[model samples]
Target: MVKSKPVMHKAGHLFSFVLGVIFVIGGFLATYLKGLPLIEQGKASKNWPTTKGVVLKSKVASHRSSNSNSSTYSAEITYRYQVEGQNYKCGTVWFGSDVSTSNRSLAQDTVKKYPVDKQVVVYYDPQKPAAAVLEPGVFKTTYFYYVFGWLFMGPGILMTGIPLFRWLVRVGRGTDERGENVAGKF
Candidate 1:
């Protein structure tokens, strides 16, 4: 049983190290793959062509959590615009606008800003006119995923780095003060 304890300890460390690596990868993917694109798109949207559009539907949508007694709110604003004689309907207010928040006031404020039938400027991608948004440019939410990535990466670096650093130190020393080989111990 005593022997098994050391083996189990090593196994646990190995698992944690692997998990940390996964976190690092996941964080990078989240930042670059998911977040960077949104930010870039949002930035590009600022230069997109604009057209007159009317709000067809604007309201706050509430969603309840499945696992807990909690709810989130999101602004569900639908607007329609015409580009080069082609009409397009979209619900995007801004980039990453689909994300819901625990703050109901934010959603409510959005709904109040764009009531139904209100005339608004819609920005559309010239390459794909069907893609559009009411508000352009990167907002605070644009950095959400990018910052989220660092959350995972920070811990991952510590987990993977600490063990590797210890191993390096052991390798450099080769033996402890008592002349006991410590290189095998990481």
Candidate 2:
């Protein structure tokens, strides 16, 4: 039983380290994904080449949830553009990319800006010509990613830092002439 206690103690420390690493990685990944929209938009504005595209299709798709009997709507916009005699079809119509909402009117309003056959400007990534967006801004969802990222990261740092800090405190206190653990005497 005594031996098992030490094993359990070691297991606890290992668990804390592994859990902290997982949370930190997830936090960073979420933050990175949140920033992708802004990065793509910024890149498009500065150096991405643009071409005229014809709106092949534009509509609001309302997807109903069977569980809650609720619906979420998204503006579905598909356009085709040609670059250097090569044609490409892109479905990314908004800066936020397929901006969706629970409010049907919001989706409908977005679709109006790009009716079928309407001519509009399309921005394409120079390196990957197929990647494009009609809009170049982020949505409210972007902030959610950032918020969740920090929520995970805060505890992650605490989990990792607290152990290291406690170890340092113990090591520092051990140098005292008493040669006794402070908490142990108490």
Cα-based lDDT for every prediction: 0.90, 0.76
Per-residue lDDT over 53-156 for candidate 1, one digit per residue giving the tens place of the 0 to 100 score: 99999989999988979899999999999999988899989988888889999999999999999999999999999989899999998788889998998999
| Per-residue lDDT value at 149 in model 2 | 78
Q: Each prediction's TM-score against the native?
A: 0.82, 0.68
For candidate 2, write residues 1-186 as lDDT tens digits. 256876888789989978998888888776677655454464455457789999999989988878877888988889999888899999886555454568898778878989999998988887778887776545564355667777887888888888777777777876332356665554
Query: What value does the lDDT take at residue 73 in candidate 1?
Result: 94
Worst lDDT run of 10 residues, candidate 2, spans: 175-184
Tell me, by lDDT, which candidate is best.
1
**Segments in model 1 whose C-alpha atoms lie over 4 Å from true places:** 1-3, 165-186
For model 1 the TM-score comes to 0.82
